[model samples]
Target: MIKTAILVDGAFYRKRAYTLFGDISPAERAKELSAYCHRHIKDEKEGACLYRVFYYDCPPMNKQVYHPLLKRAINLGQSEDYVWANDFFKELKHQRKFALRLGRLAEEQAHFNIKPDVMKKILSGVKTIDELEEKDFSLSVTQKGVDMRIGVDISSLSFKKQVDRIILISGDSDFVPAAKNARREGIDFILDPMRSPIRDDLYEHIDGIRTKAPKLEKQNVT
Candidate 1:
C-alpha cells in the first residue's frame, strides 16, 4: 500500500477554491478538500492510505490604517478580515488528519503605485494625473518564510523516506528544485493544481497531475 502525503498552499487554495467551487464558506471548503484528497488517494492506488495533510498559510494581516481618499481611520486588527481569518484557521486546526504550518507577513511600507491602465490614461489625456482614484494604488504585502518552510519540509520528508508519494497543491514554480530532488530520492511527486494553469517547465518534474471536479447543483423540481 502506498503512503501519500498532501501539501496545500492555503492562500492559493483559498483563491482558486472560490473560483472553482462558487461562494462556499471556508469551513465547507476545507471539508471538501480533505474529503476529495482522501478519495483521490484511494482511487489512484488500490490500497493507498493517507500519511498526513500539511496546510501552509499566514495569519491574517492585522494593521492600523487610514485611507487617504476618505480621510478615515480603519483598524484592520478589528475588521472582518481579522475575524474571518481567525475562524478559518481554527476550523482547519480542528480537523483530525490536518497539520497547519504558518508563515508570517513582514512589516513594510505600503508605497503608492499607479495601475497600468491609469498610467496609460494619463499619458493619453483621457484622465489627468489628478483624476486618479484610490483604486489605482494597491498595497503590496510581502510574504516571509513560506517558500523556505516548504523546501525544508520536502527535503526532510524525502531524506527520511517518510512517504511514497508527495502531492503538492500549488501553482508556483519556486518548488521546481524541491520537486526534482524528491523525484531523485524515488518519491513519486504529483501536482494537484485544482484547475489552475501550470507552467510548462513544471510538467517535466512531476510524475502526474490531477484535480477533483466540482459537483453542480441540481435545479429545483417545479
Candidate 2:
C-alpha cells in the first residue's frame, strides 16, 4: 500500500465546508473532515495507507478589541467564535492519524474592516456610510507561520521518504514552491481544491487534482 499524507488548510476547509455542507457542530465537523480524508485513501490506485492528516490553522484571537461602531471593547475570549474554535480543536485531537499544527494570530496587527458586501453597497450608494452598524464590520486578523510550517512539513516528509504521496487540501497557490520541491524528491503531489476553480499555472506543479466531497444542492444560510 502506498503511504499517503493529507495536508489541510484549516481556514480554507472550514469556509468551504460551511458553504458546501452547512453549519455543523464541532464534533460533526471533525468527523466530516476525517471522512473526507479517508475518501482519498480509498480512491488511490494500488491501495493507499494513511500516513497522517496535518491540519494547519491559527488559534482564535482571545483578546479584547475596541469596536468602533459599538463604542466599546468586546471580549473575544467570551465570544461564540472563540468557544467554537476551542471545541473544534479539542474534537480534532481525537481523530485517528490526525496532527493539528497551529500558528499564532498577529494580534497586534489586527484591525476591523467593513464587510465586502457592505463596502460594495456603500460604494454603489445602496447604503450610506452613516448607516453602518457593528454587524457591517468584521475583525480582520493575519495568520503567521502557517505557510512556513506547511513547507517545512512537506520538505521533511519528502526528504525522509516518509510518504509516497502528498495531498494538499488548499486552494492557495503559495504552496507551489513546496509542491515543486516535493515532486523533485519523487513524491506524488496531488492538489485537492474541494472543487474550487484553480489557476492554469497550478497544473504544472501537481501530479493530479481530486476532490471527494460532493457539492450541496441547497447551501445553508449561516
Highest lDDT scorer? 2
lDDT of 2 by residue, 1-222 (tens): 999999999999999888878899999999999999999999877999999999999999999988888888889999999999999999999999999999999999887889999999999999998999888999999989999999999999999999999999998999999999999999999999987779999999999998986765554332
Per-residue lDDT of 2 in model 1: 89
Clashing pairs in 1: none
What is the C-alpha local distance difference test score of each model?
A: 0.79, 0.93
Lowest-scoring 10 consecutive residues by lDDT in candidate 2? 213-222
> Distance from true position, residue 120, model 2, in Å?
0.8
Q: Estimate each model's TM-score.
A: 0.83, 0.95
